[model samples]
Target: GGLSNLLFKCALPEHILSVGDEPRQVLLRVYGAILQVSASGAGIPPDWQPPPRPAAPEQLQGSGLCRHLPPGPGLAAAPRLLRPQGVDSLVLESVMFAILAERALGPRLYGVFPQGRLEQYIPSRRLRTEDLRDPDISKEIAVKMSRFHGMVMPFNKEPKWLFGTMEWYLKQILELTFPEEEQLKKFNHLKTYNLQEEMKSLRELLESTPSPVVFCHNDVQEGNILLLAGHEASSSDKLMLIDFEYSSYNYRGFDIGNHFCEWVYNYTHDSWPFFKASAENYPSRQQQLHFIRHYLSEDSGRRGDTTHEEQARIEEEMLTEINRFALASHFFWGLWSILQAKISTIKFGYL
Candidate 1:
């Protein structure tokens, strides 16, 4: 369900279940696409071919780009999640997972290692892009997100996660050297955009909007959401959010706005590039209001037992904040893809 990691479903031996509390099955995640391929040192299969480069930058910007490519063998390797130094990223991630599990906001963590983890395997299926538009499902997601944002985490809460990570990725993009003619051509195209200036402007725009800092899932696209099997669509527990590797304390608007941008993308395409973006499918204002209403209802911190008029004003301000932060989502992922293109040996067309 993710482009950056490889997941495997593992079943425990029959005799092990006698312990009673042991999970019968677990999900194994091997982090870093290229690492998944090289862990065994065999590298990518010789017959596999790299996908074609993406279309013009203008076209991609007009319509978003999504990496929904199916998992494939990879060749090269690179560092995993970008994080601030001093603290160990893997240890910090494990702590976050443990906390979420204790709070019932995410899957239970079974085991953690240098390069991957074992997690509780929820019996569920991923929600598709269109499922986000479902009235009941959208409302439930809003409620869960409200709770997610309310969580008091131990991580730094200065709201620097988005900007810092994006700046790091930008540095990687700028420092990359593509000596191959074709690769250089792609690099040249990327050079046309002043990414540094774009980042500065985006930061200023989002700061002016003033969204609250809170714990965020960071990546809430359909692939990361699972609808538990046997639960009715109206059930409160129907949906679960997974893949918190990128989770951090950040602006609330970035989380919600990034999710809204996902409404226009379908990542399940089976062909080369393996994603489709229909800008027209972006949610209408009415739809946005519906989601916001449910979110505000559950968010006591924001709603604050205020009068209806006060709540209405809050909602109106949030609508503007969310839409503006959507641009930051674009900038964040755009830099990510560029770096992945240079270092990841995964077969997807990151460019």
Candidate 2:
């Protein structure tokens, strides 16, 4: 049962007691906490003075979370709320950015406010200068983030499990593949998922290799990367990843592939903003080619165990894998939206 009207008293040198009512009944820990009953049925009187919440981030005026709680339930809703509704999400994201900083002495990610929606306030230090641009720094950050993905820490209230079984996998595959045409089929929700050798191939894949599932940030878009102060000043100003609301447990290759797709699409189809024209910050295409060639070589450490047969098939079939997985992701998201719509009786588009 959620605490109906629980009052938690803060028991620190600086007395702060938290009052929260949630959908679950459980004790929580803050710097120091206390539990009490608020004066029953009492509401704040009009004559009583209470502090006003911040109206704007600028108005927050750089006063840190330690001094004030950030305004709105935006961040609280962020780790789960998805699909845009006007400027609401974008605006909230802007506010969140204002509050977050990095730690120098630890794992290095620090939001200005670590209590309430963020987490317990830990002893945090300032952001350092060397942890951003260096290849070693990038790798370190990527690795740490990978661990979090592997943990697949559910942001929503529910504990998550990757799609239940091979049957589920087969169903999704069948839903995407085409029976009437060898080429990709336009999806029809009412139509049955085409069943063919594709289903067999998928079933074989699931049975043949049982990979350890890890959390993947499926939408690893450019906007999700939070870059610190530029490196020109010799500040490492590393990339801190945000927007994990779209995480799933799946093959890590998809995570890399998703990133690759965005990078490739942006560079090839969009513009030079990604590269500084001289390939300074993020490499130009040629530099990217060199990096992939030299850095991804067998001795370069990018290798994961791939069977010679799988490698051979990969050249023949890797593209198929990408399309298949992407199609699956689409179905997953679409089905997810439909379910959410049905369950909540809320309007949501399916596609």
Candidate lDDT scores, in order, read: 0.74, 0.34
Please provide, for model 1 over 143-179, each residue's C-alpha lDDT reduced to its tens digit, 9 standing for 90 to 100.
Answer: 8888999999999888878988887677657767665
Write one digit per residue (lDDT tens) for candidate 2, span 190-286: 3345434544565465344423345566655454454444434344434455544345456544454444344332321133222212223333444
Error of 2 at 290 (Å): 8.3
TM per candidate comes to 0.83, 0.37
Off by over 4 Å in 2: 1-116, 119-161, 165-215, 229-238, 245-249, 258-324, 343-348
Clashing pairs in 1: none
Question: How many backbone overlaps does candidate 1 show?
Answer: 0
Which candidate has the highest TM-score of all?
1
Q: List the residue pairs that clash in candidate 2.
A: 8-34, 9-34, 10-16, 10-17, 99-112, 129-236, 132-236, 132-238
Please report, as a residue range, the 10-residue window in candidate 2 with the lowest summed lDDT.
Answer: 30-39
Candidate 1 wrongly placed segments (more than 4 Å): 1-4, 15-17, 33-87
Number of colliding residue pairs in model 2: 8
